[model samples]
Target: MDDPVTFARKLRREQTLPERRFWGLVRPWREAGLHWRRQAPIGPYVVDFVCKARNLIVEIDGDTHYSEAGLAHDESRTAYLAERGHRVLRFTNSEVTQGGEGVYTVLMGVLGEPGAER
Candidate 1:
């Protein structure tokens, strides 16, 4: 496998459609002091999005994530992250593509910026 940093860089360039959309949606949050990173490396995993200041990691799940092996992997990953004091939020690709506003609303609450105008 490639180095985590190098793999993360590649992921940033080859973002899924949902990733691109979610990144765009959250990019403006930096003005609120909630900076975000896309395709960021955390230990051995490359998370879809993360806000280090908040210790939050957001994952966009695709079909592969619903598989048996995938579920196990995610469980371990989530546990590893939790042990390190990071909160993980997983959303399906369809959720982002179809219910982006709702997802944003939830994220604002998690980030303690509930009053942020969408």
Candidate 2:
């Protein structure tokens, strides 16, 4: 398995729009109580973002994710994480970019509190 730091570096080199938005918000959230790992591998997949402190995974999907096949793939990924005792939260690219406050709210809810200590 790749180390989290190395994975994060790789992700930075290949940054995407959704990743930038998610990481923008994730930084503050990490300081509050959550620690997120980018491109963190789990089982046979590399999750978008993972907060092991909370056993949570956050996925940001792009337009291509609207396809039927993409949805099915996401469902399977979520199920895999669930089976591994992790909670998965998914958001679209637009949602994270245009709905920053809403995204933060949802993430806070999942993380338990705005100032939750893990």
Best by TM-score: 1
User: How many residue pairs clash in each candidate at the backbone level?
Assistant: 0, 0
Off by over 4 Å in 2: 1-10
TM-score of 2: 0.83
> Which residue pairs show collisions in model 1?
none
Give candidate 2's root-mean-square deviation (CA, Å): 3.1
lDDT of each candidate versus the true structure: 0.88, 0.81
Alpha-carbon lDDT of model 1:
0.88
lDDT of 1 by residue, 53-97 (tens): 879999999999999999999999999999999999999999899
| Model 2 clashing-pair count | 0
